[model samples]
Target chain A: MCAAASSPPAANPDRKSNAGATPDPWEACARLEYGGDRSPAWSVREELLATPPEGWPAAETRLLKSLARADATAAGRAFLCQMLALVGSAQSVPALAALLKDVDAVESARYALEAIPGAEASAALREGIAAVSGSAKAGMIGSIAIRGDTSARYLLAGIKGNPSEPAIVREAAGRALEHLATAKA
Target chain B: MPTASTVTRRRFLQQSGVATAVAAAPLILPSGLRGAGAPSRKITVGIVGAGNISDSHFGPLLGDPENVRILAVCDVDRERRDDAAARVNRTYGNQDCKAYGDFRELNRRSDIDTVFVCTPDHWHALVAIDAMRNGKDVYVEKPLTLTIQEGRALVATARKYHRVAQHGTQHRSMKRFHDVAEFVRNQGLGRLDRIECFIPPNNRHVGATWKPEPVPAGLDWDMWLGPAPWRPYTSLGCHYNFRFISDSAYGQVTNWGAHYLDIGQWALDMDASGPVEVEGRGEFPSSGLFTNATKVDFTVRYANGVPMFCRTRFEGGGTVRFVGERGWLDIARNRMSASHNDLLREMQAPGKKIQLPLSNNHHENFFACVRSRQRPIADVELGHRTTTVCNLGQIAMVLGRKLRWDPAKEEFVGDAMANRLRGRAMRSPWALI
Candidate 1:
């Protein structure tokens, strides 16, 4: 069976797929770099390079929706995250925020939300701190600091002194609060 | 309005004198117990950020006989994650390897004992800190952190958790660099007074407008920009090229700087600390997605009166040239030379004083230390100090002034503006602390 088409592109199938046909060169490039072997055909990278690096709103939403599909492979979701970093905006925040609690999607979701510039993106990340813990919580705090969102100062101050929180979290909160205080300065 | 508000805040900080103290607090390591159930018989491994650099590590790591297992791979790019995991399974002739789109999943596993942090500079802090907090040793690529504060937090976390962390200034493990650093330190070049370090501008060239592009399949663009400020992606703005943009990295200053500058620190006997003052000026692209300097020139001074001038130009294909009372010595990636032709012969005789730590391979050193629990050559503190040099140079470049750094405090000397730039504020879901 042709594995590439067996699961519709929109379906975003699981990592384990029917094995006969080769994935599209774009997907292949991602695979080649991620695995032990790099240097797939130059043609694969060029296929991506060929796409003009502008005006991606439509594709961004479509890919975000694709995450819910049962067929979504780890590679496919990761790929979507990468693209979102380039094209994502406040509109992409809700989808990314929802994944803030998902262990597998949290980092990429945070990555997308972090790079997006808007109050809504900041809100989602601020909200994310409550939903996640450990690394994910630390990551959300890091993103809030990166955004320079001073509105979270009170929230961050609370975390800095919150004894029940992990030491890493408190440390991150202190660092972010300093940034907000200094950035506002 | 921004200027007014900023001035008011600055005055408040300056009047109270409290913020500086908070920023300059000692890097105390808090108590953190190791995670339970870490594999004892074999070191379980995972990979994060499977980019081109991943190739350099995977071969050496995956091939370690009987003691190493590549159990999982994670990356924002799905294709890379799945493919990398599949490849690992293929190498071991099994289908047990797991693919994760989020590094947190890799961080959550008590079974995996180590993680290869091959991500971009910006993601290093969160990923490394999280893994250490969860009880995994890390081999993180350099400039260890994108900002000085991030480096401090990571170092504290490593110490607090008692994890063996290796920063990816691989030159520490190479014999060529080790040989020269030892010779310079041992007075082979006589009383060292000055050293000149150099690297290429590495800005390359590209157009400016950072408009959004069509999000590609099999790539998570958002995850790629983790913890960095939001900007619409241009083709050149993402991928390995993120270095050019000041938002994600400090260009070749940190890129090439992390490797060669590290060697300088080792030679100058300043690995445990850093320069006391830094002043620099360089050419920045007037308009583009990249904001780091193109033609770099920076000068740093140690407390010992040894001055190191760093530049981005070529003189004899050299990475650094150490000048001493006897003569001068030059060393680069491919070759090394000295004022006296016989200096090489004398140094190679093997009874040389001050023999530096030796590790012929970076990957081997890291895994060896994992078992022994000894600090690798490029340990977290060493990595932090070296990266601090680059950050200082870049900070001075941006501030357009000579800034005195209190290396003991790891903060600028009363310069709130420069101090503030030490690290950036994160947006959400991420903080460097």
Candidate 2:
């Protein structure tokens, strides 16, 4: 559909005759688009997409990849979430929110939740709390308390330092609990 | 009807006669027309806009020795103005050239014979009118005026003041563009049916939000805004970002659309006329920084059965494509391609002529007319007509309705609501006259 609308002008001998008379080649090119069959639309899009991946900023590349797979499967969504987290795009919060309940992508969702900044990130954290289980939920609550506003105090109070948890997760929860306690005082 | 050979011979003879007469009479006419010997003195030229387009105009004007001398420069920002002036002075070795923070101060100088009004759309008319009133000719950037009424006034004022005003629609100066237009019109390219103009999208506005900030020091924010309604400063409201808003500028339609569409109109030989009807659909920002249409497809129909299609996001930057009964031609700034290699070869061949009273210099075209007392290549009427198409597209987007325009009367046909949009209410102390 996009290609047809942007198809280059139909080739004609007369247009060439006219353009050939032009003294400057650049001006001829400017006129050829209106007078020729070449679709500038297709060329512009092709050029943009052809730009090297390394040439694009990390955030732009992540956004492009996410948009490319926005309608893909749960695993695809998980991969996108992981990529978004790595780039630290606040733009990833909405994507993470949409994926929070997809059971296969819960761990990726947790990473996205941790990566989002400020209030929106805390909301994603709250949503992740109900969908994930055990240590993941505890970790999300600790992340929420650290990143969220005053409204997150109640979530902070629910974090219990279980011995079975990884040492780093336990330490993060302990620190969040201490911070929440200090805030209350 | 006269045969093609007879018409061509007659035109050549007429032009030759005029050229010979002009050479013989070396007198300056009252309407500020200069004959061949009017004066070889170089006129000093000043540049008003020191933004992205400074290089485009600066290089061409500085390179042409017959027309002008690099004199002074001005920008709202002192640093840019100084830098532009320094560059010109260094290149031309004219050490006494001055830099101005205010265009009004630059206009006060008697030594400056012409002013390049390359500022933003909002400032084009204001500076051009002021420059003319100050007895200086003007070469304004394209889309000539910000509003329909302003365009009309600029054209009228230029004539009334005997000032030579050239809108910077430089494609008119290109031989190839004239050939394309002539070929299409002459039936060498078959029947002209459809013309499409494209402006590609850039990422400057993607996921962007607008927040007002204090006007920075070393900038006159109000003057920069000019005739645009008073508003708090935002990064998006000035410089390269100004086109994204309706209040400050007309977005891409007039930004790049003006140039491409000007070429389209020129090719169609509609320099003194425009579409009778115009309509469009596009996505405008619902909130945050941008208010201009992000994506749009607009169609304008001329009285002569020609349709102009202008679209955004078909590619990037801007391009114009013409579709004729026999074939088509595609043109952008840097490239030209045709389906038939023969056509490209033929277009490049010599002896196939399209003449435009050739002047390799835009500023020279204006100065020659300043002396000749004749219209420049991109004359006011031509500028108004081309700019009207752009303004019509903008109005269609703003009103979100199909508008019927009377090219002869230069007004909306029985549509009072649309007609009202033909001009804007100028802010006080900045009168249109």
Candidate 3:
């Protein structure tokens, strides 16, 4: 039974050093699995992160994994994306950018992208555009149009002949092209 | 514009005062009953399972001050128990109401006269039996029990206790539902040949890939699992999403199907009996999460040449379309449309014979039965029969084969393995006894 899975022992000073070194957040998340009246395990993690220990980066990455593992809401995912970006580890970039293509996390991913360094972030945005279809594509194009990026307009122009393209996508593409031409003028 | 009759002019003013006084009496007086200075009587009602559907019942039960007073609310979830208690206090202006995280504690309360078994399907039989044993009348929610054995045990317990048990099929009390059921049975729509019951698709996902989250505060996860084998806390199993799983619920078959199938049984006058032959086909997701069928079309044939068909997402939720030799009747909540208006008019005629009991109030009907010690219009047996039809449909879909059912014996005829599936082994400390 999933509920019967044994919870890890309470935090002991001796165990703290080993727990701090573990990179996966899911290991800590597994300890918090009982449902019903038990208080959330994330609250404890938040308290730990409030004043991070000496080995902060590994703990932060582990905490991000725990948040992602416990992703029940958009807000939680957004919080995880933000935390990963704050840690600024190159290893966290793929996990944060992965949120760019997740329908639930797209908007938060855009915010996290602003904090991401250079071409990797741009490449992630392009990949996110390619990954989305239907109404989601239009939303992506609208965001790109708002940023007023010429590269986004160029990519949006190439996404033709796909029937799945939403009306909003076509509208946003036209608006992006107009914004680009006007910027040139 | 106006010449008043001579007799009316003086008499009207005198009559108006008495009428005003009579109308005001119920409002102004602490107790509403007229003439006698008898103290107001309060019916003690206890609620089990303070989950989402509890609010649906609470609105009506607490709203009707004339008939009911919520005495106690119980839930495994401490948070929900407190929330329901607060709502009850706010609704009735009483602060002394009790709350219990264990239903057994609520059942043991001598103050509670009637028990509302609103818990998950698995807990229904145990709590209801305990309440009955404690000499409390019961108002159980639909799809009466989780399994056939549990249904049988519940009915047996009700009989042993000689308690009034009312299934939560509120439509039985509605005027329109009565008219539709009477129309089909009385041959107003001619000889009923086929009936179709529809339930909408459930898109909620389940399983390992659907990760478990941190358990919310003020919840008792261990108690929530109750008799079911323990599983890690997932929102999917706790709230409205519980319907998507097999462990806690029977999926849509018992949830939405219970509502529609009750109407079908009522229309067919098969409250005591059900279809003998059951068969069906369905589509399940190939992978990732959901286990219950996405779409299913099932048929059950009664001995008297009537066949009832159930389709998931064929149209929408809780819909019943009765096709007769002449015309068909389609009815859902608050909407009853027919192929022929004349048939509907005939059903509405004065002195028309309908088997439905005259009780406009669902809660009141249960309360009345509690006092009078009579069977409600929808009794335990009727609920079991209707739920059996639903269970049969699910069995057919799961087995992908035809079934022969004996409603008299309440067993699948000639299939030992299928017969065994009718009941489940309860986890320890949650015995049906």
Q: 1 or 3, which is superior by TM-score?
A: 1
Q: Report, for every candidate in turn, its global Cα lDDT versus the true structure.
A: 0.71, 0.63, 0.65
lDDT (0-100) at residue B411 of candidate 3? 87
Q: Which candidate number maximizes TM-score? A: 1
The runs of at least 3 residues in candidate 3 whose Cα sits more than 4 Å from the true structure, single-residue gaps closed, are A1-185, B1-40, B206-208
> What is the fnat of model 1 with respect to the true interface contacts?
0.18
User: In model 3 chain B, where is the ten-residue run with the lowest total lDDT?
Assistant: B27-36
Candidate 3 docks with a DockQ of: 0.01
TM-score of chain B of 3: 0.88
> If both were scored by lDDT, which would come out higher, candidate 2 or candidate 3?
3
TM per candidate, chain B = 0.88, 0.87, 0.88
TM-score of each: 0.67, 0.63, 0.63
Mind giving the per-residue lDDT tens digits that candidate 3 earns over B1-433?
1112333423322332233223211111121211111223456789999987777889988876765678899987787899999999987787977889888798888777889999888788878988987878899998898888778878877886677788888887677786788777777777787888888776455222455677788778877776564456777567766666656776778888888888889888788889888876655443233446667667888888788888877454568888887888899986888888887778777665554444454665566455445576668888888888888887766555567899898989865435645765343235443
DockQ of each: 0.08, 0.01, 0.01
Candidate 1 local lDDT, residue B226: 71
A1-185 per-residue lDDT for model 1 (tens digits): 01221332122121112112344433443342221122222232223222332435655555566656655555455656655665567778888888887877677677667666679988988888888886567778877876789999999999989899988788888878876775643
Error of 2 at B81 (Å): 1.4
Candidate 2, B1-433: lDDT as tens digits: 1222344433333343234225322222344422322455566788998999777888877776555687889999877888898888888787877888889889878877778998888888879988887888788898798888789879877876777688888776665665566555555556887888997652356436555687788888877876554456776567888777666567778878887898888777787788888875555543345656667667788878788988886545577877877678877777776656665566555454442334333554566655555567777778988888988887766555566789888898755445545654333224343
Off by over 4 Å in 1: A1-185, B1-40, B206-210, B314-318
